[model samples]
Target: MTGRLKDKVVLITGAASGIGEHTARLFASEGALVVISDINAAAGERLARELGMHFIAADVSKEEEVERAVSSTVGWHGRLDCMVNNAGMVGVVGSILETGAEDWRRTLSVLLDSVFFGIKHAGRQMRELGGGGVILSLSSLAGLVGGVGPQVYSVAKAGVIALTRGAASELSAYGIRVNAVAPGLVMTPLVEEVYGGHDAALRGGAAKSPLGSAAMPQEIAASLCYLASDEARHVSAHTLVIDSGVSAAGAGAAPQFHHQPADFLGRLPEQYQ
Candidate 1:
């Protein structure tokens, strides 16, 4: 039987791992001709082979690489319908004061400029298709608020949300839809590395969640499917937060340090709790 994306052509960056890998598999399973772009040639080729999709070793942060990847997909598939800007780097876990200039540039280049390149090149291709295309970005809760670790990552993500809004407003005139997905702490390989590859760290991330767990890559991939499908045709310039309510209450993995009231003990002692 045919699928929702049968005959559609989708291009996804950072397609070698994490959300991008899952998204590529999901899109191909749904019958779309997938173009997987990533700097990791081996993983990209493996996934493309496994999923029967096209693979391109291109760095999304570079304009020439981004252009070549997008052009290659359009040239190979005849038309481009969906673009997923999922290429990004996880910066060092440090405060803004500790973050070096080079690290900051790398973080912004990977997380922010990559998306900008995707939108610019993909926008051109989708416009050629007369619009009716979708551009989905993988932003984070950091995009909306600031918190623990990686100041550069946070700032870069914030830029993604702003980019989403700006592109959506202008691209709508051309019939192209632009949106973003802000994933909470998901249990991807990236997070595993963040946890020092310890199962306990994964468990800690899960335990910290308001939902008692973080999401799986598949969960985020499904959201990507919905966003790319025609069902979300009217949805533009919006961020679908898949953060398990962490962004809402600031619940997961964050410190809570509020002093208990000492009204009753106020009369008893000055140093009492």
Candidate 2:
């Protein structure tokens, strides 16, 4: 896979941590001149220093910031080859009623509005570069299934998926490919923060999955690389779900919980003891 992205210039948002950081490093490793953008100046700069890539501190939801990020990359590298709109915030985990209006709006702005702006700005640059470009978004499987995510988070991601398809359809004429990756529970820092700072949620998510494991950020990055590379030239206006068979299983399935009688002895809770 060496040189799959060689000499390409990419701009990735949320490049300070988690999947975004992983993708930035991976893209650089594969020979792309990556422009890592994030709100976290320290983390983003640290990553840029470590990877020998450029760092831009920008909030993707804002038009000016996003334009600057895009413009800086083109100015530095001469052209933009890909844009990974990965910056976003998960809504507070609760039922629709329990979620506040402000929380909802904030989540939408970061998660949904950011993608909208990324495409609007990045698409323009790709067009300016004469149209051999790819735009891959970090949507989630939560967008595909009903009742899978916190209300606002899922809605925003669903919008990302729809946005991806529409962008692909319209941009194909310009030689730009738009696509999304819908990943299931990966052990990212954001996920850890959302799950109360323990590995329990990730472990539980993995245990319940058919593969009995969670994907590493690098695994997701590999798929992203394929989409950005010439290998997937015809792949456009599509979303690739990378869940470990979680999307394929029924809600009632309990096969993972089954245990032999000899292994089934249970202990009382500590509180009860």
Best by lDDT: 2
**TM-score (all chains, Cα) for each model:** 0.89, 0.89
On the 0 to 100 scale, the lDDT of residue 134 in model 1 is 90
Structure candidate 1, residue pairs in collision: none
| Model 2: per-residue Cα lDDT at residue 113 | 88
lDDT for position 34 in model 1: 96
Stretches of model 2 off by over 4 angstroms after superposition:
251-273
Q: Global lDDT of each model?
A: 0.80, 0.82
lDDT of 1 by residue, 55-78 (tens): 998866678999899999999988
List model 2 lDDT by residue over 53-127, tens digit each. 899999766778998999999999999999999987664455565556765676687889889889988899988
- Backbone clash pairs for candidate 2 read none
